[model samples]
Target chain A: MIINARYIAFWGCTIPALQPYVEKAARLVFGELGITLAEPEGMTCCPDPDITHMASHEYWLITAARNLALAERRGLDLMTPCNGCFFTFTEAISELKRNGKKANAVLSENFNMTFKGKVRVYHALEVLYDVVGPENIKAKFTRSLNGLRVTIHPGCKLLKYEEKRLDVKLYELTKLTGSTILTYGLERLCCGVPLMYLDADKAIELRTKPKLDRMKEVNPDAIVVICPACHNQLEKGQLMISEDEEYDIPVISLLELLALCMGFSPDDIGMYLHRIPADDALEKLGLI
Target chain B: MNEIHPLRKRFRSLPSSFKGLLRSELRIGHIYELTDLTVSDREDLGLPSKPPTAYSDPNALEALKRIAKATNLKKDTGFDVDKLDFEW
Candidate 1:
């Protein structure tokens, strides 16, 4: 389908600063799909999913509401690939709606602004799966990864949050590139971000490592994730673990895969930035 | 998270629902359901380590109630907070 669509690309804190390659890949893929990832000025971090929530519920709510307010003023729905940002926005919006009067009062008194909760917040996978859709995603598949086996982290915000409920679109999106999504026992575990402030070792030992250990048994070509923090955790977790001692599975984003499938070369689509090189995965698919 | 919030002290002792969501934060394990296990549960099974805590954070229920309750706008008007559980 030939048409124009626009979304306020909520880059949040991680992607632009630590993970620009994700932005590069997402841009390339979205450009190819004819979707516009608009960047409106004056938007800040989703603050954080766990940190802000734990540190100050009030400040977390206020900061997150600010980003949504900016997007709402723009009349465009917010879209983000970071599950943390997605959680912040989605959770904040939902909370604001449920308690509009009180939230508005607090926000107005402190920041001289009100959150009407008008705009919709969406994860990148949600937009791709629900808006761009599987059929269209399939139509753009120029390089097939049919034999490539991948593991999906799906991200916590998209899956577990009680209100935001999990959906199958991320699964469907991963399958669109013709890659196999390897399922394991600990597939739904956290990335250790919440405990990041409390204990780093515990986050890895308890969450990331066990899941990686189990995924090690499956021997997938790469791990696919929709969230940036999870992307960093899984990728960084491998580096933290002794590759000689554990699974050093490569991690890649959903947009990167879509870019590769849409005829973009590995280097052009920002594959080199991954901690564990995606070269092997791309070369295996003959997209090098 | 910042230094000014109340949750910093409350995090360790938050209700079971929060604890359940902490361990099963991604909802992949479903801690409240049969899928998740505690540290002792893991040890009993001969697993190497205990799971970290991080479950689905209600996403909004607590925030809504907290905000409303703070402003004295909360009402029992038959609005079930339990219905907030299925929001994904």
Candidate 2:
């Protein structure tokens, strides 16, 4: 199937450092699906860090409006895979839509430009869901993720704002690939990564650990993550917690994991970048 | 017993005074209480049961306020305080 859309593949800083593998895997999968992704010039941070830090609401809006303006200038829809970026961008759009005159006036004054409301923000997963279509995705699977239990972490941004718009449950995605999807009570929980910059220990103890505990009780083989923040927090947070108790489930990007079962190699999908190591999990599936 | 106000019921259910303050700080234009959220509920709401390491910072209250405002939950649904029991 061919889906044509020019997208600004906004990485928002974290992708290169902690999630290169995710970008690589996405490129491979999306390339095969015939979707084009490009990085627009003059793009800035999604204003998430500033907004979450409680910066002035006007300042946050100005910053995010600038990013949207950049995307609009290029006539491309902004597609972000990072949860924080998605939240920040989507929230900005929501706010502007709610207060159109004030939002546009701020843009006109600060950036000397008008926000014509031309850009549409989308998470990368939505693109994948659309192009791959669950049924076709199932057909692409070379190996079944059958018998392997997994917990899907939807992350805060994926579910909090307009959750119905994004396919967070991913039941269709998993079922299409011949895997059994098990969602625990914490399935919709935040991984507490945002609090990491503030309180590593507490974010771990309360936000991260509980989800791990829930997942452990179910004894899932791995935790599948959609947001990079959740992926980093859950994976590294578990490793830190593992020092006190044996925590062994591999944390994987949903894209990389799906690529593996679809017969792609670690090299093909850039699995080498993972800090928690997918080798054991790979060996289990005999992909190594 | 009389039917309790959603706000008062939520306030009584919190495990700590600090959480009550957090609930209060976040309440703003809406009403919120501890009973409206369990630990899992808090997680779902993107508010953690255990304060993040940054919880000690004086800025946390402000951050939470920003989050609340950005999400536009200040007027609708109030905080569902009864969900905090952690039974789930």
Candidate 3:
């Protein structure tokens, strides 16, 4: 696979701060695919659509524009692993196109930077499924997760973009691993990471519990997720409710799974960093 | 989220998400900061102790700070970026 696509790797706040394991796996997997991930120099948070936008939409717009400008200067599109960052950057680009005149003025006056709207944003899921192609991915895998059963959790933000519905992309990419994706009725449901800000208990009972319960019935080996926020909510939410029932389903990132099959050791990707141990799933992969 | 409804009236006080925003602004110029343990973990994984983002780059952090001040983010959020340090 001679994929010549190169983009600025947007390691959003969560990956570096809370989910370095995902970063480790992504570096390994993307490297193997012949994809070049250039790190953007002055990148900040996508400024967080949920939090920053709530406090002040104007600030959110400007901060996101600054990040976008960094990529535009480099003449490369920005690609992020976080669904929220993807949603934020995509929506920011659209909003800027409509009202970027004022933003460009502020950017020029403050930092002498202007987001000329030259850059495009991509989620790693789209890059893998569309650009790299699943056949190329399958060709690179040294072993297949033939009998591994896992349930998919496509986070909420990725679903809202109608043009490129990433849920289907996530499903198709997971299938390339040769794992049977257990059908769960609530794949589209939000993992309730956003709601945790308002009410933690209700976020668990109303959102996380129902999804976990549904997947529990299927008795899959793991719950696979792409978003760091979803990974945090699903994995940490289980430990929060551990006193009540044992929802021991380990949450694995799609990148980590691909890295495993590509012959990287589990330890190499920081599987031990998971709040809920993925020992059961790793053992199934013969990685333990 | 603010498009759905204004968050000012939605919650009586700052939510964790709001603190997260402040943390991004005032603490490390990102949503989460790196601890010693996490830094060591990155080293073990053959990655840089700190990534090349704003938190690691002094120039980037300066740019973020300048932008935050110019945009009145502290005023809009109704908290002083210098004070009210909760270690977020």
Candidate 4:
């Protein structure tokens, strides 16, 4: 058990608006694991890396700094499940530390905020693996996910900052649930989310289909993920592909998997809201 | 290429990105607005209908609006923030 296992939950735009089930599962899993995810008022978007950064580099930095300053004010570290938010925070924090004086001047002038660089940012996996050790997790597990076999989809941003070791953390955490992790050739490929804006059909066919086709060869029980964007892209992309092609692999968030092992029912974590019904996977776990 | 390109001559932004930015600037401080169905689903799941972030906090939206103004986002992107219009 880690001391002060609490963080300001940065629920990036995608999870709250598009996928609330992921949010619910996170809350349930964290609560069971004795972690406090405080939702402080007035925290805005991680500003969304895809659009905000592309629009204006300075605006993105100042906005992210302002959000970071909110957590700094409370003297608490921040964590997010969305890979996009994690990437933005890591990038913004790094840049702000270099130009701290200029960024703070803008924050203090406009928002009466200061980015003093007092806080640390983390992906939820870091909190799970690094902060709360594997020993604690092993002690807390009520049931084993021994028979369940799944493939991992560690989204693009997690791979960007290799030092974070998020990919290894994800694999180890899934292993804690006793699920077998199957490998696919295109595991490192993008989920085609960023390309969707340019051409939806081509995005699926080019980026997503190749990955799905490779994963299909192994025939896993579910596709596990940490980022909501990739989870949404992969699950939604399957339907967008040709009707003749069969790609019905259920995409499950990592938090939901841990929650199930901690003795929470599938419905407790809102697995019912999954785009690809987790019914087949749940049936395998004898959870249905 | 410029003449035939769907995104180049007109909006100069992807439709999804443009629409998402407009939504963030105008209403919710986040990209996608919390629809009624989502709200009901959240409540049914025993969580708050709206999370405590910008969706539920007016000050967060005000801060984002001010940040946009302070950083010259409107000028840089040529988005008419006042009228909530982006030239298509």
Candidate 5:
């Protein structure tokens, strides 16, 4: 199967900070698969978080519309990995498609630009799951992650955006590459990253603490995160909370795990960036 | 392309209150259906049956105390008092 190599690798604000490891792994794997990811110049912050909080409903529409316009101007479909960016782009595109004239008019007036209303935005997980087949990912695994237990936290944006509303199907994609997925009571709860900006204590209480407790019970070797925001929040939040508590499970990007299973070194995949060291797992795998 | 625009405009033009009603319906209309299973739901789903106990190591508490004190000092001093009070 031939996959098109024309899509833009859209990295919002968090990407530069959190995605070097995953991005490196992705390029290596995609190169092997004969797929090329293009990174366009002059792409700015998606402005989703800011617009959502500071702007009026109309202004939010224009802010997101401008991003879509920018991507469309590049003549490339936007492929975003950040859940917040994906939700904002997807929701903005959907809204504009639902109301193009008003949305385009507002965008034009605000940003001095017009959008053709013809770009498709995809979340990285969607690209990986649908475009890059799970069988292909399984085939890339030279090192089996046999005994290393993992828990997946599909942030609210990822699961909530799906049309069918099924949990098992949502989780099945993450469990595809022969790893034991730990199922815990608070599996579906938010990681509280979204609420961090609103109420830090409550968000921690409601989101991270519960997951930590649940993870301690299951004792997973690591936690797999899909969203960059969730990854940061889980890593920093876990470290902060662990200072008060005891368990210290490492948090990792899902792509990093895929790279590990494919026999990529910890340094090769940027595993050193993690707050909680994955050396214990690497030692167990004898890759250290 | 033209077909989608007008319908969306009309949809958005409805009274804000009417839109609120639609939003409410969208939020509450779904009644989730559950599948019948013989095993205990938690066991069948492999979900943890009980909440995990909290780990309270003394060293962790000391570290947390040090962090809290540092954070409090940072907050009180505003990280950079000169910058906070600066008039540029």
Candidate 6:
């Protein structure tokens, strides 16, 4: 048997503070796959790549490099469940390498740190679908989500980077859980999380509502997302729009859904953490 | 010298499920080369990057261009020695 590849779990800021349940479910799934996820000490924000990258390129690179330096210290790559965090780390590394000597020089002089550009970064979906094959992961499913139907809102950062690869991995793994992926027209839309930084109202209108309206048609058991920011935006975004009976679909993390298939009871992963609880999904999957 | 898998040349290995298995280590920046290990042992020992060729993330590049254009900075410019200069 191939020993699982070890990695530093980069939880970013949201998952720990807002969605501890994601961290919990991800830990459970990682254990089942024989993957070793180490949480490095002294880690800070992925620092909001969308803003930092826009506001100050230098600070963004420096902050992201500090996180990368932490993983390099352990001789391991970083794995993140949040698309924004993954984009910050991976994009920072990609930018840093373009002018390796200069970026390294800046780090050594200002922060007294060196970025060897060796450490790699991956989104949680990438690790699940790529490192752990879909079949291998499917084999670990003790119980199946037999009748469940899901609609996924893949966050924009991942779409901007590796849409084709991320898209393939997501459905393949979702199918492995024995659930049907309900198709929606705006499945590719942003969660409006980034827009919240610029325009709260417009972000809600352009990002969440239209997509949620489309998602309603499939009448999915749940809306699953691989990005924590999306998880927060979609759920909280739903609440911000309107509390009417017209719009009330629960949003969940991809790890939580996979955990259900892997024989975890909904209560175990803290489904209550969701802004809109997973009661319908849980009851549908017969876990209740 | 070993050969880079024709499919992996563009990082598009067929049977998507098997593509991730073929490469030794998936590096975002470095170019990958052929593996010397037997087909069975290949996945065991990650294929290493020798020439260390660097590549850009298209999304990041495109976004950075927008950031640069909005900020009135050169699109290709990033952190450099000029930003690091400090005097005691």
Clashing pairs in 3: none
TM-score of each: 0.73, 0.71, 0.94, 0.93, 0.71, 0.74
> In model 2, where do residues sit more than 4 Å from their true spots?
A49-53, A100-112, A162-169, B1-88
* Ten-residue stretch with the least lDDT total in model 4 chain A: A1-10
Cα RMSDs of all predictions? 13.7, 12.2, 3.2, 3.2, 17.2, 15.8
TM-score of chain B of each: 0.20, 0.29, 0.65, 0.69, 0.21, 0.23
lDDT of 1 at A33: 83
Interface RMSD of each: 15.2, 15.0, 1.6, 1.9, 19.2, 18.3
Order the candidates by lDDT, highest first: 3, 4, 6, 1, 2, 5
Q: Chain A TM-score, candidate 4?
A: 0.96
Off by over 4 Å in 6: B1-88
TM-score of 6: 0.74
For model 5, what share of native contacts is present? Answer: 0.00
Distance from true location, Cα of A210 in model 5, Å: 1.0
Q: B32-59 in candidate 4: lDDT tens per residue?
A: 7889999999998998899887888888
Q: In candidate 3, what are the lDDT values of residues A25-126, reduced to their tens digit?
A: 999999999999998787877888787778778778988999999899889998999998998999899999998987788889987889998899999988
Q: How many backbone clashes does candidate 3 have?
A: 0
lDDT of 2 at A122: 81
Model 4 stretches with alpha carbons more than 4 Å out: B1-16
Better of 1 and 6 by TM-score: 6
Write the residue-wise lDDT of candidate 4 on A1-288 in tens digits: 554688999889889887888898899878877899888567877887886777778778888899899999998999899899999999998998888776788889987879988899989999889888777877778988899989999989999988878999999999999999999978899999888866888898899999999999999999999998899899888888748698899999998898888888988888899878989999988998
